[model samples]
Target: MQLTHFNASAKAGVSRASSRRTTVRVQAAAARPSWFPGNKLPEHLDGTLVGDFGFDPLGLGVDKDKLRWYQQAELVHARFAMLGAAGILVPDLFHQIGAGGPAAQIPWYDHAKFEYYAPINALFGVQVLLFAWAELRRLQDIRNPGSVNQDPIFSQYRCVCACV
Candidate 1:
C-alpha cells in the first residue's frame, strides 16, 4: 500500500522542492477611460490633436484623410448654416419692423412660391452653378492641397482688392 515511486525518487535525490521554478512577469494593462468604459480609445486619436478627447463614438474619422475632409465639410456646412439662419432672421426681423419693402414682407417659407418667376429661376440656376463649381474646387483642394489657389481663373482675382 506504500508509494514506492516517492521513496525511489527521494532515494535518487529527485525532490519536488529542489526543482527549478520559473517566474513569469506580466505587464499591467492600460486603464480604460471612465467615459468610454465599454470601448477602447481609438489609437489614431492621440491627445496631441486639438480638442481631441478621443470621443469618436462612430469611428467616422478613422482615416486621417477622411477626418480632414469631414472637418472641412463641417466648417463649410456650419458657415452655410449661419448664412441660412441670417437669411431667415434678417428678413423676418425687417418685416416685423415694417422695413425692407414688399420683399421682406414675404415670409421665407413663401419664397419657394416665387421660384417660378424667370428672374428667380435664373438666379437659382446661377447659384446652383456657382455652388457646384465651388464644391468641385473644394474637393480638388482636399485631394490636392493648394490646387484651388493656383487656378488661373481665381488667381487673377486674388489681387483685385490690392488697389484699395
Candidate 2:
C-alpha cells in the first residue's frame, strides 16, 4: 500500500466531499457512513489509484478527538517546516527552480543552507505534532475549556497564546 499525494487521470472521476482527509473516501461513497467526513484529496501511487485504503491495517485507528488535534498540528508544522526548509532550499517562497515542474513547484535558492537541518525538520515536525496533541488534551482537562473548544484546524493553527 503505497501512499501518494495526487490522483490519476483515470480515478480523477472521484468527487471531493470537502470533508475527507485522503482519497480513500471514495470507497465509502456507497455507504457514506456518518463517522467519515469525506476528503477531497486523492491518495495515489505515482498518480495511479490502486484502491482506497479506507482504514488501512497499519493500526492507524485512533481517537478522532486526538487525531483531530494531531492532524491540525501536523498541517501547521508541515507548513512551517516547509517554510523553514524551503528557506534553506529557496529563501524566496515565490522563487522557482529551473526543472520539470508546473512552475508553481519550482523553488528559488537557499543562501544559508544547513546540512543538519533536514533531520532537524523531521524531528521538529514530530515534536510539533506531539505538542499540539498534548495541548489539546490539556485544554480538554480544564473545567471550562473555554473558546478553544473550536474545530481541530482552529485549535491547531490558533496562536499558541490563543490556546488560552
Best candidate according to TM-score: 1
lDDT of 1 by residue, 102-150 (tens): 7787899997764444787688899999999889977976787665555
For residues 30-133, write the lDDT of model 2, one tens digit per residue: 54222235733322212221233343334342454654555555677788798787655543334344443333343334322434446777978999999888
TM-score for each prediction? 0.60, 0.27
What clash count goes with each model? 0, 6
lDDT of 2 at 96: 44
Candidate 1 residues lying further than 4 Å off, grouped into runs, are 1-39, 48-51, 115-124, 150-164
- Give the root-mean-square deviation of each candidate in angstroms: 14.1, 21.1
Least accurate 10 contiguous residues by lDDT in model 2: 41-50
Over 4 Å off, model 2? 1-55, 89-164
